[model samples]
Target chain A: MRNRQKTEKDTPLGAEAAQRRHRAVLVILAAALILCLLLSFTLGRYPVPLRELLGILAAKLGLPVEPFWTRQMELAVWNIRLPRVLLSVLVGASLAAAGAGFQGVFQNPMASPDVLGASAGAGFGAALALLLDLSNSLVTLLAFGMSLLTVALVFLIGRYVKGDRLVGLVLSGIIIGSLCQSATSFIKLVADPTNKLPQITYWLMGSLSGASWRDVRLAVLPMLLGLALLLLSRWQINVLTMGDDEARSLGVNAPRVRARIILCSTLLTASAVSVSGMIGWVGLVIPHMMRRIAGSDYRYLMGASVLGGGIFLLAVDNLSRTVSESGIPIGILTAFIGAPFFIWLITGRVDHYDG
Target chain B: MTVEVEHLAFAYDEKPVLTDVSFTAREGQFLSILGPNGAGKSTLFRCILGLQTKYTGSVRIGGTDTKTLSPREMAGLVAYIPQSSRPTFNYSVFDIVLMGASRKLSPFRAPSREDNERCRWALEKVGISHLAQRCFHRLSGGEQQLVMIARALMQDAPVLMMDEPTANLDYGNQLLVMRQAKALTKEGYTVIQTTHAPEQSYLFSDRILALSGGRIIQDGPPAEVLTGETVETLYGISVRVVSLENDKMRVCMPINII
Candidate 1:
C-alpha cells in the first residue's frame, strides 16, 4: 500500500528528470547554434564588430533603433553575410535530416543521401546548365528534376531485378553515379575552357558565393516540409530499422513506409544539393555525431542532428570566408574540418559502430 | 476469441507449400504445432498473419475474416514473435519493447505516459525490468528470447504466436519460457507456438498439432498426440515417451543408422 504509493510517486519524477536532461541538451545546442550564426554574420572581409553587427541586424528587422548605420555595412550584413548564413543553416538541416532518414531506412549507419545517386544526378544537371549558360533558377530546377528521375530509375531497377531492395538500390546508385560523373566530365570537356570550365569546376567544388534571398526562399520551404515529414514518421522509421519481417509483425506496411521515407529523404537532399551545389560532409557526418550524442531513438536523433548540422556548417562557412585573403570553397573547408571529426568518431570507443 | 482457418492453400513461385490445411484455436488455450523442417509451419503462420497474399485460405480472428482487416487492425488482435530475432541497431531493452505499442500510436503522436508504463510492465512481466537500460544485443540467447516476448506483450493483443520459442534456450530457460506460455493462457490470451520438442508440449500445452508433408497429421490433447507411432511418423525416427514422477513426460529418440 504505502510502498505502492511511493513507487507511483517515483515514476513521474524519474520521467521528469529524463525530460529535463533532454531539455538541457537542447538548450545548450540552441545557444551554440545562435552563437555560430552570429559569428558567421560578423566574420568576413569587411568585418563588422559583433555589437555593431547586431545593431545593424536589429535595424534591418524593424527593431527599435540602430547604433551605427552605413551603406557598406548594410550591404555586408544584408546582401552578403545574412544570405550565406541562412543558406548554410538550411542546407545543413536538410542534409542531416536526409542522412538520418536514409540511415534509419537502410538500418546501416554508413548509409547517406549520396548512396542513391541523388547528389551525382543533381551535379550533372547543374554542370550541363552551366555549360549552356542557363539562368541560376533554371539550373536549380533542372537539378531537382534530374535527381528525382535518378531516384526513380534506381527504384525501378531494384524492382526489376527481384533482388533484395537495399542491395539493388545501392548497386543502381553506383552505376548511375558513374554515368552522371562521366556526363559531367563530357560537359566540362566541351565548355569554353577559359570561362565555363572554371565556373563548372568551382561549382563542383561547392560554394555559397552566389547566395541570395531567392535561393533562401527556394530551399527553406521544401527542406522544412521534408524534415517535418521525417519527424512525423520517426516511429515508423524505428520499426523499419528492425528489418522487414519484424517491421511487418509490428503492423507496418514495410515497403510503403520505406518508399515514403526514401521519397522524403531524396527530396530534402535534392533541394539542398540544388541550392548549394554539393556540400559533401554535412550529410555523412552530422547524423553520426548526433547518434553518438542522443542515442539511437529517431525521435530525438533527428532533432539533434538538425541543430548540430546547422551549427557545424555555419562555423565551417565562416571559416571559408575569413580563413584566407582569397575566400575558400565551402566544400573544401567543410572536408578539412569534418574529416578529422569523422576519423575521431570512428576510432573512438563507441560500440554502436559495430552494426 | 478464437482463430479459425479453413481450406488453406499456398504456393511460392508455383511450388506448393500448404495444401487444404485447417485448424482452430480457442480462447485461453495453449496449442503447439510440431513438424519437420520443410512442413510449411511458417508459411501457414504467414498466411494467417495476412503476410502472404498469394494464399487461398479463409482465416478468421474472433469471428471476423482476417482478409478484411488491415495489417494494423490485425496486429491489434494478434502478436507474433519470430523464431530467431536480432536487433540491427543497438536499441535499449525498453526502446525495443516500446515499439510494440506503435500500432496504437498515430504517426505524429509520441509514445504517451501510458505507453511507457505498459512497456515497463511488460519488461517486468518477463522478469527483465532490471535490464531495461541495457543494449538488447548484449544479452545472452535466453535473455534475448525473453526480451522478444516482452516486446510481444507490449502489443496488448488477445492472441500471441511464436515460432520455436525455446529453440536455443538452455534446460532452465526452456522450461522458463514454457511456463510463461502457460501463464499467458491462464490470463485469457490464446497462444500458438511451434516447437520440435514434444516433451515441452506434454509439460505445458493444452493441445498438440502434428504436421507432415504440409498437412495436419494429428490434433488433440498432449496425451493423445504424443504416441510413439505418431512421433515416429512425423520425425521419421522411432521415439519413446515416458512419464516422470512429477506429472512430467520425457521423450527419447532411439539409436538408428538409417
Candidate 2:
C-alpha cells in the first residue's frame, strides 16, 4: 500500500488556489459569452453593422448618442433579433443549470433536465394548444402550467412507489413522459395535415423563432428564481453527492435539500421549455463539458454551466438564422452536434464517470 | 462526550435487527464492537448516529437526548465515518474533506477560510497533507480510509463513530488505521468502531462489546471480554486466543475442523 510519497512541491495547488483557478475559468466563460452576444448581434440576415448596432443599443438605453442607424435597422435589432437572442441566452442558461442540478441531485451521469418529464409535458401542452388553434401567448402559458403539473404528478406517483426515492422518481418520469409523447402523437394524427401538423412538428423540434419580449418576460421569473436557488444551494448539493446516509451524518437534511433542488430544477426546465419548445442536448451536453472544465464543485460548475450553455445555444441559434434561407430549428442543430460529441466524450475518457 | 443508551430495540418492518442493546462509552475511551457478518453491530451504530431512528430506545449524547436534537445538533455531538465507497463524480480529496465542515454551518454557507485551515489540520493529523489535491477515487484503499478519518476529524466532534473503517484494507493498513483510532482516544476523543476481527479489539480497544444476533454477549476490557468462549459465541468458530510472550498482545487463531 506504500506508494512513493510526493513532496509538497510535486502536489497540485492548494484548495484556495484551486478555487481561485476555477473562478478564473468562470470569468473566461463569461467573457466568451459576451463575445458570442456581440458576434450574434451582427450575424443575422439584415446585417446590422457593429457601429450601428451599438448606436441602436445606446439609443435604446436612452444614452446621449445620435441615431446614425435607420428605422429598419432599429426595428431589426429591437423587434426581431434582440428578443430571439436574449431568449436563447435565458433558455440556454436555464436548461444547462437545470441539467447540471438534476445530474448532481440524482447522482446519475445520464440525468438531464428532462429526467422528471418536464420537457415532454411542455411539448405535449404546446402541441395540444396548436391543435386547438390557440394564440402564441396562450400556448406558452399552457406549456408552463402543464410542465409543472407533470412534475407534480411524477412526485405523487414517486411517493407511492416501493423502492429508492430517486429510482421511483426516474421510473415515474419515464412512464409519464411516454404518456405525454403518445398524447402528442395522437394530437398530430387528428390535426390538419398541412397547417397544424407542420406547426406541431416544428414546435416539437424546438425553435427560438418568433420569440418576443413577452416570452422573455413570462419566463424570467421562474427561471431566475430557479437559477438563484440552485446557485445558493450549491454547497448543500455537494454534500448530497456523498449519498443520503453520509449527508445525514454531515448534518444535512438530505430529503429537504433534495426537494428544494427538484423544485428549482423543475421551474427552470418548465420555463425554458415553455419559451423554447423542448430543446434537447444543451442541458445534457453543456454540463458534462463544464465538468471537465470547472471540475465538479457546484459552486463553479453551476456558474460555468450557465455561461457555457448560453454561449453554446446562442452560437447555435445564430447559425440557425444564418445557415439557410428558412433557418433550421435550434433543437435539430443541438442534437446533431451534441450526440456525436457526447459519444466522443464518453469514449474519450472512460474514467469521467463511475462504471 | 459520553454516549448513553437505554433499551435500544430496533426492527425493520416485522423483523428485529437489534434487541435490548445498551452501552455507555465515556470520554477518551476506545470501544470496539466485535461481531460477525450477520450481527447487529452496524444497526447499533446506525441507531447511535441517528440515521435509523425507528428504534425503541433512548440515545443521549453529552446529556442531551438524540430525539430532542436536530440532525445538525446530533452531528455536532458525533461524527460518523462510513465504510469507504466510490462516489459517482470524482471530487478531489480536499473537497470531500471540506464537506465535513457542513455540520457547523447553515445550509447555504460554503466552507470558509477557517474551515479550510481546519481541513488542512485534519489532513496533517492523518499524515496525508500532500494528498489533499489528489482525486479521491484514484487513491489506494488505505489512503482512502485515511482520507475518511481526516474527514471525521474535520467534523471536530467529541465522539467518532466508524462502521468498519478498515473493512477493505490489507493487513498493514488495517493496523495503521486501528492505530490512528487508538491515538484519537488518547487525544480525549471517544472512539467507537465496529470490527469483525477479534485481534483488532484485543490490540487497540479499551473496551470490547461482543454482539451477536441482536444482543450484547460481553462488554468489558479487551482482556476480560476477548476470551476464546466469547469468540466462539460471536462467530460460531472455535478459536484459540494466544498472548504474545514479549509484546503481551492477544491474537486469535481458528482451529482446524474436520
Candidate 3:
C-alpha cells in the first residue's frame, strides 16, 4: 500500500531550496545592477549632482521633469557619463555571458573569452589601428573583425585535430591566443615611444574612459543577439554537460549545437573586446563566481552571469574614477581584484568537479 | 511491443562486425543476448537504437522500420541503458531523470507538468524516489545504475535496450537490477538485454541468443542451448553448467581460460 503520488522525492525539497537561493542571488544581482547604473551617474570628474542626473534621465526617457539642471550640466551628464555607463554594462554583461557559454561548450572550469583568443586578437587589431593612426570607428571595426577571424582560426584547427572537439578547441585557443598576444606586443615595440606607444599600452591595459554613443550603437545589436542565442541554448547545455555519447542517447546533436553555441559566444566576446579593449577577468572570474552563486544548472547560471557581470564592471568602473582623479585602467583593477577573489573561492571550494 | 531484425549487417571501415544477425521478440518477452568481447553485441544495439545508420537490413519496432523514424521519433519507441560509465556532470538525480524526456521538451524551458509526473513515476517504479534530490555522481555504482534505469523508464518506450546491465556490480546489486529488469516484462515491456552471464540467461530470460564472431552461433531456450559443449565452444574455454535446488536453477562457471 504505497501511495506514491506525493513522495518526498516528488518535490525535491533540497533542490528546491537550492533553486530558491539561486533565484534570490539573481534578483539581488539584478537589483544591484540597476543601483550601480543609477549610482554611476552621480560619479565623475566634473561632478553632476544626483538631482540633475535624475532630471536629465527623466527628460531623456520622454517624461516631463522640471529643468533643475543647466545646459552645461545636462551636456556633461547626457553626452559624457551616460554613454560610458551604458557601454560598460552592455560590454560587461556580454563578456560574462559569453564566458559562461564558452565554459559549457569547452567543458572546462577555466574557460573564458580570453582562453579562445578573442580578446587577444582584438587587442592586436586595436594596436594596429592606433599604429596606423586610424579613426576610432576604424579601430573598433578592425578589432571586431580580427577577433572573429582569430576564433575562426581556432575552430579550423580544432576541426583538423579530430578527437574530442572540446579538448581540441582549448588547445587551438591557447595557440592562437599566444600568437595574437605576441603580435600585439610586436606592434607596441615598433610604435613611437612618446604618443602612440602610451595610447596603445593604455588601451591594451583596458579603459572605458573614451566611450561614446556611436560605440554603444555599433556594439549593441551583435551583443544582444549573442545574449539571446546563449539564453536560448541553456537547456541543451544542461544535456551537453554530460559527455557526447550521453547527449546523443538523449537525441541531442552535440557537434551542431556546440557549434551554434561557439558562434554566439565568439560574437559576444569579439564585440565586447572591440569596444572596451581587453577587459580581462570579467569573462574569466564572473562566470566562475556565478557558478558558485547559482548552482551548475545553466538556466540559473546564465541570467545571473549576465546581471552579475554588469554589476561587477559597473562597480569597478566607478572605482576606476573614484580611487584617483586620473583613474586606473579597468583591466589592472580587475586583475588586482579578481586574483584574490579567485583565491578565496578556491579556499572555500568543495571539490565539485563534474565527475 | 515486437522487435524484428532481418539480415542486419554492419561493418566499421570494412572490418565486418555483424553479418546475417537476426532475431524477433514479442510483447512481455525477455531476450538475453549472450556474447564474448568484440562479438558485435553493442554494435547491434547501436544499429537498433539508430546511432549507427549506415548498416544494411532493417530494424523494426512494432512493424515500423527504424529508418523512417527520426531520432526524436525513434526515442518514442526504444530506450537504452548504456553500460555504467561515470558521467562527468554533477546534475541532480531528478534533473538526470527528467533528461530522458528531452525529446519532447522544447529548448530553453523548464520541465513541463507531464515531464515532472513522468519523472516521479519513473523514480517510483525503480523504487528509488528518495534519492531524487541527491547528486548523481555521489551515488554508488549500483544506485547509479538504478538511476539510469529510472531515466530510461521516463522515456516511456515500449522496448528497452540495455548493454551489459550488470557488468560491474556486487552480487546483491546485480540480482537487484536483474530482478527489476525481469519484473518489467510482466508489465508488458519487451526487454532486450546483453549480458556476459549465461546463468542470468538460464535463470531469468525467456529465450537466449548466443553470438560469436559476428554471427548467431546458437539460438534456443537456455535449457536447450546452454550445454557444457556449446558453452565451451562459445567462450573458447572449458565450462560446466550445474543445476541446483532440485533442477530449478542453473549456473555457468568457466573451468579453464582458453
Question: Per model, how much of the real contact set is kept?
Answer: 0.42, 0.65, 0.39
Better candidate by lDDT, 1 or 3: 3
Two-way TM-score contest, 1 vs 3, winner:
1
* lDDT for A27 (candidate 2): 94
**Whole-model lDDT values for every prediction:** 0.83, 0.89, 0.84
lDDT of 3 at A1: 12
Which residue pairs overlap in candidate 1's backbone?
Answer: none
Q: Point out where model 3 deviates above 4 Å.
A: A1-21, A44-49, A351-355, B85-87, B246-248, B256-258
Task: Give the per-residue lDDT digits (tens) of candidate 1, residues A1-355.
Answer: 3454345334644333444555576678889999888777657788777887888878878999845767788888888778888999888888888999999988888888898888999989899899989999988888888888888888888776665778878888889888998999999999999999998888888788789988998888888999899989877888989888788777887898899999999999999989888888888899898877766778677888888889888878787778776778888888888899899998996644222
What would the TM-scores of all predictions be? 0.94, 0.97, 0.91
C-alpha positional error of residue A318 in candidate 2 after TM-score superposition, expressed in Å = 0.8
| Chain A TM-score of each candidate structure, as shown | 0.91, 0.95, 0.93
Evaluate model 1 with DockQ and give the value: 0.47
lDDT by residue (A1-355, candidate 3, tens digit) is 1333234345555345545767898888888888888889778687777778888889989999978779988888888898989888998999899989888877776788887788988999999999999999999999999999999999899888877777888899899999999998999999999999998998888888888999899999999999998988888887777767667667677788888888999999999989988898898889888877676778788898899888888889899988888889898998899999988886785433222
Q: Mind giving the per-residue lDDT tens digits that candidate 2 earns over A75-145? A: 98999999999999999999999999999889987999999999999999999999999999989999999
User: In angstroms, how far off is A51's CA in candidate 1?
Assistant: 2.0
Model 2, span B155-226: residue lDDT tens: 888999988988899999999999998899999999999988788778889999999899988999988998
Interface root-mean-square deviation, each candidate: 4.8, 3.1, 4.0
Mark the 10 consecutive residues where model 3 chain B has the least summed lDDT. B85-94
Measured with C-alpha atoms, the lDDT of residue A70 in candidate 2 is 87
lDDT of 1 at A326: 70
